[model samples]
Target: MTDKQTSPAVSVTLESGPAGTGSIDDFELFYARRALDRFRARLGRQGLLDLLAADIEEGNAFLRECARTSDGEFNAGTTVLQARGMTSAEFLAWMDAAFAGEDERPLLAAHPEHYAMGTDHIGARVVENIGPHVCSFYMGGWGTAAMAWAEDADELLPESEYPRKMSSNLFLEDGTVVGRALIQFGDTAEGFTANLTVYFPTSCPKGVLDHHLRHYAVEFRNWIVAAAEARA
Candidate 1:
């Protein structure tokens, strides 16, 4: 994760227009480097969200919301009982689902809400940890969920199982949302690509997320390409 400047040999063929004539090899080199650089670069100190709830239920609810908004990973089975830790990407997917109101009913079923039913199926819905850091979050509840997507339609959820949120709401506060961008180069995919989609809402004006996402996108793309070549 060194920030050494890249050599001049690495460059993006910007002139190669819509008609397309840039060397794919060079593009791959550029993409990989830029991805690594942005990854190591320091994150801004604003626009972040963190939470801590005083009430256990609310705190647990908030945790649920966090899981809903986070990414998780799975073992090669369609069940949480057999699966393992969460990944950054998986946490993101879970967050999107929570935001979409996919699992509110079951998530809200914490104790006081339902006691007999609670102890019956508690061991399953849990997330080990999402990020590299350990203390970013703590567990709340447990259950098994099967993740399905239209994009990776072919690759079914690991053993058809996805981990469930363990807790609900906690105390939430402002914290920066940090992520990286990397465009992998393949023969068919020549132009730049963004893996994460910054969504916009009906209440706000259009393109707010787009502006931010694109800004990071370009920086990440260039950084990935640059960093990959430097490592070589």
Candidate 2:
């Protein structure tokens, strides 16, 4: 296949949102480059989501950290940009080259992390610059570990023209729900909380969505208590 004719199997889709200014475009490029690094350095696609998500999380965490240091306000994704003081293009190119070489996989591995048990790997992430402004909320499971997890309601007549709301747990090939992430905007001037809720099917089953959601009330409370201790 020609270089331009690369197969569709290995394509990457940027999670599109409102386009930003010139510098924001560069920021997107930099994050995209980080995604490329994970695609290359990881032991094939078996760990792609975790690797990529972790990279993204770490970058957000840095932004939170910088906010604390400067007594400033910033969100997770762009915080890395504000702290590093590099133009978007420079960061993007640096990340791209930092991951050159090796036998790139023929097909990206499916079922990354062999199916992580509800954020087991991500929970262990030591986020530098993590402040009160940014907290990756943990949820999804059989007990009191869920912060929040949502799902979609099926419609009776689905011919497929409507944009089906992308709700519910993010899944891998095996159909196991990984987690859901949201950039939460609250009453604070900081805007919102960068939250990620990991899901486990056993805890969040079909039919009693309300009852299942109630199980997480304690988890949020637990996070608050833990945060208090950390502050003390």
- Using TM-score, give the best candidate's number: 1
The runs of at least 3 residues in candidate 2 whose Cα sits more than 4 Å from the true structure, single-residue gaps closed, are 1-168, 172-183, 189-207
RMSD of each: 17.8, 21.6
Q: What overall lDDT goes with each candidate model?
A: 0.28, 0.30
Instruction: Tell me the TM-score of model 2.
Output: 0.22
TM-score of each candidate structure, all chains considered together = 0.23, 0.22
Q: Write the per-residue lDDT of candidate 1 for residues 1-232, one digit (tens) a residue.
A: 5424677976755555545555777677667656543432332111111121133334344434443454431111111111123232333344344334433322222111111111112221221112111122221211212212212333222321222222121111222111211111111123222233222122222333344344434433433443333335
What lDDT does candidate 1 reach at residue 202? Answer: 24
RMSD after Cα superposition, model 1: 17.8
Q: After superposition, how far is residue 101 of candidate 2 from its true place, in Å?
A: 31
